[model samples]
Target chain A: MLKISKKADYALMALQHIAAVQFGDVTPGRVVNTKEIAEEYNIPLELLAKVLQTLAKNALIESHNGPKGGYLLARRAHQITIAQILESIEGPLGITDCSHEKDGEFCMQRENCHIRTPLLKVQDSIAQLLNNMTLQDMMGGTPLITIQSPTAQGVER
Target chain B: MLKISKKADYALMALQHIAAVQFGDVTPGRVVNTKEIAEEYNIPLELLAKVLQTLAKNALIESHNGPKGGYLLARRAHQITIAQILESIEGPLGITDCSHEKDGEFCMQRENCHIRTPLLKVQDSIAQLLNNMTLQDMMGGTPLITIQSPTAQGVER
Candidate 1:
């Protein structure tokens, strides 16, 4: 029942793209633009552009200026955790709105709320798992098909 | 970014109400009807009824037929896990639509989808947490306020 928001998913996908083309610590191997990623992933260019800017603002990826310059990972792939990407896009992982981490008590049953503690624990544990998971961890799943034959291997395989 | 559905939340609340009034094996100390839970939680009666039916269908809670009869925990509170409640309401936890568990591959980037592995891990880990966690774990947070003063202790405290 728990689900990650679509924007957060978009951010993950976008980050994985940059991470895949990552070159070195300071400069990216390829300064992949938003349009390039949008076309490849079939994502909306306008939406993906907004998401990329948010990533740049969060410092997960730095936006390069001028032509041929677009986006690159601010940190190494393995060094950046999925939690950071998600938090950068969706704030800290919150399973329930009435979580202790939330500012004010909006839930009516706060005092008698039985699920609060367990819900908070679930939120923390999920955050912990995501915090430990890096973008490289997700990028690791990209090796099944080789790029030799795009239509055959990449498409059908 | 991750969140449990409202129906699932309602199901948990309803089950907890029954679990709170549980007596012993076979017969409950108190039979809880859906309306009681709906009014108590301020949930819509119709929606909560459908959710309660799902809980009954999943065998998480036993349904009573007569006027005095209502609902009871199908199994002991501790015997029921939050996963059971959540699954009963929302099906198995799914982080991404393109996970291996899905019937057919839908995403165009399925072959090169780098997130499949890590997303599945997150799904499985979350399911693992919910599976191991019993309903009693959430119910444990309900011991703070006593029933002495309704307005003062329960509302203001």
Candidate 2:
């Protein structure tokens, strides 16, 4: 089955939570504590902490240490797309192992494999959808259909 | 990036090859040698052998041992969809871990996760595509379009 990993899903949810509270007059650029996030979401503190640390390392979220420490979005809510979160947590959004151009060159049949073509199409479709969507979109209750509907009439909102 | 695993890709290719040859007196029930498949497609013999074995175990293909041994499609080529091949190799097709109704019950935010709905839609879209495409479609040279294209027209022919 093709599915996103738990870590990736958690990463997106955490990002959405941060985006949701961005309007509050909390300390500007203040770090959001992992404990608060975990408690609010009812997620496992330890696991979510690790996920946050990874996000920080990937520059998806900014982290601070010491007394007034926590995590904050490294960029604006609109600047961060779901693709970035997914890539930070789950590597690349490739559909086949051979679709990755950088490391994928090592595959035995990289040059002439017919399957990579369609798989690449699938990967690109998913990536484009993820890239075009922002944390704000997810928070605004904008269904993904708004961005993906084929008819131009549906896109005109 | 989303990508298909080697096992799944190889299974699709092997099935398509079988479908192509199954026309004209070649019954899908007849055994085919692994070496023949490997040599014809220039695939890695060892890896292809394991992939074929995996398919046979999943009931996608039937295999025999010894002289008259190889593999045959367990079902008609038209009856075997790409989704079945992918599931046989990778398990289930879902964009988020929470997309699975059975497994998603354990998620901490099962009661109110907003993102789950969109991810489920993405999962369903992918499922719909794979389910609509059969191994025979691939063998018949039905070109797969890039996901960016709204039309379902074949790419090559």
Candidate 3:
């Protein structure tokens, strides 16, 4: 199945946890340990720790090494979109290799393949939705609207 | 970047090759060799051979060996959607684990997470596109159209 890797999944969960506590006075700018975050979300400790480290490496979240150190959002929750979190963990958001503009030189069929065009559209729609959502938006408990209804005609996006 | 796996990519290339010749005098049951398909599309012979075997295993295509042997579509080209070819190689088309209905049971945040809903919409959009596109349609070189332009978004399906 096409899936967000384990890294991306953990990153989102961690971001949401950080967002949930952002408004609290005591924990403001404080290091949030991976243990605490993993326990809160019921995620595997070792896996979540690795994921947290990855987020830190990507600059999506800040980390410290001393006694009270853990992780924190590098920027404000509102400033971090789901797309950034995803990209931080999973690399670029693209459906087909041919859809990537960054390395278009590699695909031999780039000049004439018709499938690339529609797949690009699919990628665009997904990006639009992800870009519109921020960690804060998710924390705000906003109702996510369906882009296509189960009964609706047309494409799923 | 979000990308289709090598398997799905090869499957599509192979299907398109088959569709291009579907209208010829050759019977639907005729077998086409992997080497010919690899040569036609300039794909690696070993890789194309493995992909063709996978397609046959998934019933997307059928194969035969011996003096007069190769591969043939298990069904009419028009009846085979792009989704089937992709799923055969990549499994379910999903952006995240939670996007899958079956995996919902295992998701830790299924009850409260907001991202799943919109992500599901994106998944549906992708599914619809794949479902609508047939091997025949791709072979016919239909001009692809999308409701939105590619650059406006950032999410990858």
Best-fitting candidate, measured by TM-score? Answer: 1
**Which runs in model 3 stand beyond 4 Å of their true positions?**
A24-31, A42-50, A53-59, A62-70, A74-78, A101-104, A108-114, A140-142, A145-157, B24-31, B94-122, B142-157
Candidate 1 chain A lowest-lDDT run of ten: A148-157
lDDT (10s digit) by residue, model 1, range A18-90: 8877753555488899998888887788988999999999989999989988998899877888889988888
Please provide, for model 3 over B38-124, each residue's C-alpha lDDT reduced to its tens digit, 9 standing for 90 to 100: 776667899888888888999887777787788777888778877898888877787787664573375775655545655555556
Better of 1 and 3 by TM-score: 1
Q: lDDT per prediction?
A: 0.72, 0.69, 0.68
DockQ of each: 0.28, 0.31, 0.31
**Residue pairs in clash, model 1:** none
The weakest ten consecutive residues by lDDT in model 3 chain B span B148-157
Q: In what order do the candidates fall by DockQ, top score first?
A: 3, 2, 1
- Assess candidate 2 and give its TM-score to the true structure: 0.76
**Residue B152, model 3: Cα distance from true site in angstroms:** 25
Model 1 C-alpha lDDT per residue in residues B84-155, reported as the tens digit of each score? 888788876778766544566467656556666557656776676777778776564532211111111211
- Comparing candidate 1 with candidate 2, which one achieves the higher DockQ? 2
Per-chain TM-score, chain A, candidate 3 = 0.80
Ten-residue region with minimum lDDT total, candidate 3 chain A:
A148-157
